[model samples]
Target: MMITSYADSALSLLPPVVAIVLAVVTRKVLLSLGLGIIAGVILLTDFSFTGAASHLVSTVTSLVWDDGALNAWNLQIIGFLVVLGVITALITVSGSARAFADWAHQRIRNKRDAKLMTMFLGCVVFIDDYFNSIVVGSIARPITDRYHISRAKLAYLLDSTAAPVCVISPVSSWGAYIIALIGGILTAHGFADTGHLSVFLQMVPMNFYAIFALLLLLCVAIFGLDIGPMRQHERNAQKGELFDESKGLPPGATADLPEADTGKIMGLFLPIFVLVAATIYFMVSTGADALAGEGLPFSVLGAFENTEVSESLFYGSLVGLVVTIALTMQQKISTSMMFTGIKVGAKSMLPAIYILLFAWTIASVIGELETGKYMASLATGNIPFALLPAVLFLLAGLTAFSTGTSWGTFGIMLPIAADMAMGSDSTMMLPMLAAVLSGAVFGDHCSPISDTTILSSTGASCHHLDHVMTQLPYAIIVAVISIVGYTVLGFSGSVAMGFITCSVLFVLAILGLKIATK
Candidate 1:
């Protein structure tokens, strides 16, 4: 029953394949993930039904309790989500969201302006994707709704901006994580003198997908370009159907809750401002604490590299919830009504919480299966130097898509990419690494089981499947252009040429979509 024995085998890929296929066909995320977990456990237990059941129980419990202690990271993230949900509910019940929407309606005259505002918020909240996805969606949803923009489209805006922005920002959590990993890779490859932050910054321009995805999102928002399933959603939104009601209410939805007429814009803006400020403060403080413990000097980058993201998020959200509750009370809302908001808010998050739990569990199982290892192995043994970047991008994308995690993909593929470049083409190291970063983001962006994707849908109050299906074509288009960029970089050895290629292709793709839709 040692799963490592099958790490390099084709069998390692089965669980995610089954899960993804079932999700696409059935549109039942829990069912797909549940079956996927069963599939993984079955593989681990060597087809022993009893062993599989036991393993499954242990895996589920392990999320909360692992290694004789509570799993603080996972629990804190869950806590953050719950608290944020409550804050969202309080905001809605106090009529702050409605007030802000009404206020914006007078200034922002159309769907394009509403979406552009969402995109702008998404970029500004670049500290963490989780924060960006949820907060931006909450802030923008009412305005977008008033402008007749589809929930799915709003989710797309939230998602396309969240990870893509975070992954590139040096001050963000994703940047810290990636930079630390790059430092290790550089050390291992005997480039210890090189600055990790510099390398990350260099990779920023080389991250074709992230750059182009953001551009594409801007185009979609400003030019009103809708592609594939997105077109249908936008059309429906124009007809006053923002989302398919048959799919049930999405997470963070407050439509059924009563709104107080006394609500003010400060009710929404103040709590959100507090949440953002508190989260950033905690991030720097925690990072500084960790650095001090290590006998190191305090620096912004170093602190970010050592910050506990989930813990910081949880603490900040708790503060945000407190402020929201106080604001609601100021509106003279009854205790019973406040409790109702709390209950409904917490309940609304259950679906996202459940999906995230299942995703984390299955991701763990996939790790044991060595799904990433097997996928990484395929990229070895004599790939053309000219195609290395493209191949690595594709491979990393595939690994991330299958595993539902970009961080996991980075851990697995970054080292391998370093080794590959060191062995045959030393000059390609940074580009190859950049390609992995782009690919990992691309894959995670598209994967239905990805936590960010789930949160994006939850934040926008859109059906998860609707968000996934609508966003896929757009992600793929950007990815394709990114592949071409990597390929050009691999061959031409010019970063500018590669980026230029992606930018040109991106513009063409957007224009073509604009024309075709017409």
Candidate 2:
């Protein structure tokens, strides 16, 4: 199961490339992933057909169940998915979602308000991207649908805020991962005295993509700015066509909410409240062990620094599900009905679960191939210090796009970025680090193969490809601005001036996009 490195260069890239191409051409995520796995195994087995077939079987076995081993990361994620599915289904069956939608419909008069509110919800649930995407999508979809907003736009909002917000939030799951990576890197490079948390906070100002993305999304929602394919989708939505009917609504998406006088708004808000509270509490409790040696103060920040997010999400969601079921019982729902609803919800999530499993398997294949390591090695040659940030930005973006993961890219590139800065220019360290973080997010935002991307589509009930197409232009625009900002900051060595400049430029770009799209 341990694959350290690859002897063949061309073979390393073939797996992901094949996966990407197949997914795009066929629009079949599962098939594409399977083919990609087979191709990777074939290359790994020195092009022997029999060897490749056997390796593929073994890899799938380990990836799924792992030889009677109950403990597996893939299984953990799958369990989380099933629990989330049950929770969502229980909410829907209890008519809480319908009640909440009706309440939101009355308050939100226009598409602009609906979108802004959705964005607000996305911001509020910043603890984890997966949670944000699903919870926000579930709550906001009914409102957005009522206003004739395209599912593509909903997915974009969900996807953008999920990873982007989590990456920037100091206490989020994304923050924990980045801190661990940077901490290790800094320690190895003789910067052990500097706190990783401190370094991350310092880079916050220079995190142009995350900052700009937040502003841009808000502006776009408020200003009604629609451009590129998103514009067409918006136009169609205005005409009461949320999506092409031929494609049909995604699973878990309700085309119509039942008309009932019994549904209460509390049915919706109460479960969400419990879910959020439980998630935060679980994080603190699980992370309590991380603060064992620390004296007094009992820092909330410190607890977040060491929290096991996946475990927290799993347990927190289970608590939330149990609460939802209790509320359903209070509503006089039959036990059999609740069980049926759970089954329906889990079944609806089958597509998403399958895609997630395949994506993880492909990621494993690519990791074994050392594709990212090969790509990261390219940053070593002679390059101008001023352009180092820009180079790192582009490299990280490409690596994340190819790997379909930003966290994985961070693990691969942060050390290289840190080492490169340590060897040559120290001033370039923060900027280069920021570049890697931003670029990885940028790529993840746009990648069809990304887990967040799939989650967003599932949450919003939009077609997966539709979400990618609509969001790509926005991600690209922000990336271009981020590249420009990093390039200028690298040369000027002024984070404040560069940030202010980028902030203004981003707003202006939003304004221009508004006008041009109009």
Whole-model Cα lDDT of every candidate shown, in order: 0.92, 0.81
lDDT of 2 by residue, 1-518 (tens): 44533522545888889988888898777898889888888777777799878877777777766767854566666677777777777777777777888888788888899999999999989988988998888888878988899999999889888888998888887887788788888888788999888899998878888888887888879887788899999899889888766766564454432323466778778877888899899888867766775553466776787777777877787888888888888888767767777877777777788788788878878887888887787788788888888889888988888789998999989889988888888867878899899999998987777888989998888888878889988888899889888888888888876787787778779778977976
Task: Kindly give the stretch of ten consecutive residues in candidate 2 with the minimal lDDT sum.
Answer: 251-260
How many steric clashes between backbone atoms does each model show? 0, 0
The alpha-carbon deviation from the true structure for residue 395 of candidate 1, after best TM-score superposition, in angstroms, is 0.5
Off by over 4 Å in 1: 1-4
RMSD to true structure for each model, in Å: 1.1, 2.4
Model 2, position 282: C-alpha lDDT score: 82
Candidate 1 per-residue lDDT, tens place, 24-82, comes to 99999999999998999898888889998999999989999999999999999999988
Residue 150 accuracy (lDDT) in model 2: 94
Model 1, residue 378: C-alpha shift (Å): 1.0
Model 1's alpha-carbon lDDT is 0.92
Candidate 1: clashing pairs of residues:
none
